[model samples]
Target: MRLKGNLSQIKNSRDNQNVDVELYIDKIEYITNKKDGRYTQPFEFVDELDTPLVLTGDCLARVQDKHLEEGEFAYQVYDKVEGEYVLNPDKYLELTVAYDFDADLTILTAAYYTVTVSNEEFKDIKAERSKEKKQKKGKGRKGRS
Candidate 1:
């Protein structure tokens, strides 16, 4: 499976030090072996900033009687950054996943999860917006773009 999306933002979770990053997959394509049980996929990552970012995770798969187990899969991203590799958790990131499957199914199945980091200025702005929206009563607004 291939994923394409923007690295929305990095937000602090329960602990102010730990950040949770959001990624959106815009498009996914299936390539190769369209007739057989294999699946080929292509995807692109949309970055908010014009810089290089890194994403790291472990691949997982489980099959039971020719069927995949649902919700029993997860890809945990340990680090994500731009320009240089940093250990800090407060950063913004986005990425894409492309995969090939050698099975009898026309479509391949997979899941992805990520963490991200961003600069201080972007972080503050995101934080302020989050606060403002929460302060409102109704469902704030609609459609950012």
Candidate 2:
């Protein structure tokens, strides 16, 4: 899913400098399901930047550890420049929120993204199977008697 928004403000404190942005959810709950009387929802968030931003570092401050089934989750921040596009592994952070299904609580899946790009170029490209390939028939046939 894609989100569109602006970098409203930036806060620089004694501890650290954080960025504040806003984004609109074009599609919500893209992945989610209810199994065995439990509900799980997956959400994604992306930030659109007017100016190119560099990712120095990333860290997972906190993660939920209750009411969620064991699963792997990943989060990343991307930089789409005019000439090149790149993904920073150092900035690409991930966290796994796990919980036993037998627990009484429920697990909620969510993600946040910070994208720094000069402009918005919304392009939808879909890959389709080529029709040039032909199906092969069975080999070593006609072995009847």
Q: Choose the strongest candidate by TM-score.
A: 1
lDDT (tens digit, per residue) of candidate 1 on 40-125: 33322222322323232211111122232432322322333354333433222222223335652222234333323234444554
lDDT of 1: 0.31
TM-score of 2: 0.20
User: How many residue pairs clash in all the candidates, one count each?
Assistant: 9, 0
lDDT of 2 by residue, 18-91 (tens): 22232222221111122334654332223333343333222122233355345534444434456444554434
Deviating ranges (above 4 Å) for candidate 2 = 1-69, 95-145
Could you tell me which 10 consecutive residues in candidate 1 have the lowest summed lDDT?
57-66
lDDT scores for all predictions?
Answer: 0.31, 0.30
- Worst 10-residue lDDT window, candidate 2: 122-131
lDDT of 1 at 27: 29
